[model samples]
Target: MKKIYILILSLILLSSCKEKLTEEQIIVNQNKKTIDSLTYIRHNLHPEYLKSDNSELVANEIIKNCFSVLEIDRKNLEAVKDLAHFNFEIKNYKEAVHYYTILIDLKDDLNNRYVTFYYFQRGLAKFHLQDFNGAIQDLQQYKNENTDKRTIGYSKACYYLGTCYKNINDQSNACDNFRTYAENVATDEAWNLVAGYCN
Candidate 1:
């Protein structure tokens, strides 16, 4: 009888000392809150694409998204230049000109060589738009800055300048520029065309 009484007392003590359930429940609840916060952040900050049927609308939407997120101050000038290239691919010539101008301005900040690539592209656009005088000016700039005489671009610039001058009825200047192109980067086909036509 004494051993049975002791055993019952021990069982009563053990049961009374059991931990409260609140602490365990709180940890699980806290973890759930953390997950919910993460989910909210993920949904809020993630980029969403526009649903559009038109190709041009879709392209404009993408460009808008790109402009919003682009960090111009983050030393990503090259990225800005590449965005101009993308704009050109989409046939947004005016927008391409804008971006290329911005990129050209950034060159001073980067302290790099002043590239005439933007001028060349912008000149091409102006040429297509029949802004022959503007095209001629930009092509001249391209030519003046060109240090290498052997480059394909140099030859092209010379030929374009000749064409522009010819359009303006300055035959002497046109002949001179075309002759320079022929002498310098003269591959047979391009040179022959320039020589035969400009002469």
Candidate 2:
């Protein structure tokens, strides 16, 4: 249905711009529309949205669209990121890790300040997958690059690091990270973690 819609739209556009635009330009315009549609769906979907009966259908469409976008350009950053985040949101941690790896490989094409959180996000995904050592490496890099210790990003990283460490029986590191989280977040839950384990 979407393919037909796009084809019709492309034909209309191509006909209207026949003298002014080339075939490749028309195709690019069509691709942009597809990507915009995908972005809209991705942004509008809440975590709870998955409870709907159509949720799996919508998710499958998005996954298919993401792969279609990637087929056009493997290094297409937005497509790769959307796919990575989509998988992560659905709790498909392994696929999230795979796509995040591709995103990380594109770091040279990204702004340093903007892309730093990719590490933190991928670390969390790895943590969910129980890849504790990989999560530690990514989260540690995120911590090093993200100098603002007061932000939620740092606090969350500390929290996850503590859990990952605890999972691996590294009590000392776990306590230290929990203490850091408690200091920065100051949430009751964070303090409880510190008290329950660090103290």
Instruction: Note the Cα lDDT for every prediction shown.
Output: 0.66, 0.83
Candidate 2 ranges with C-alpha deviation above 4 Å: 1-56
Q: Which stretches of candidate 1 lie over 4 Å from their true place?
A: 1-65, 71-76, 111-114
What lDDT is obtained when candidate 1 is compared to the true structure? Answer: 0.66
- Give the winner by lDDT: 2
In the range 1-199, model 2's lDDT, one tens digit per residue, is 9999999999998887885667778889888877776677677753435776776566666788888777666766777887787788778889989888877778899887766888998999999888999999999889999978899999899889999999999999999999999898778988988888877
Error of 2 at 10 (Å): 32
- Full-model lDDT, candidate 2: 0.83
Highest TM-score scorer: 2
**lDDT digits (tens) for residues 40-135 of candidate 1:** 423432222123345455445445544533532234454465457657756777777778778767766753335577777766666666677988
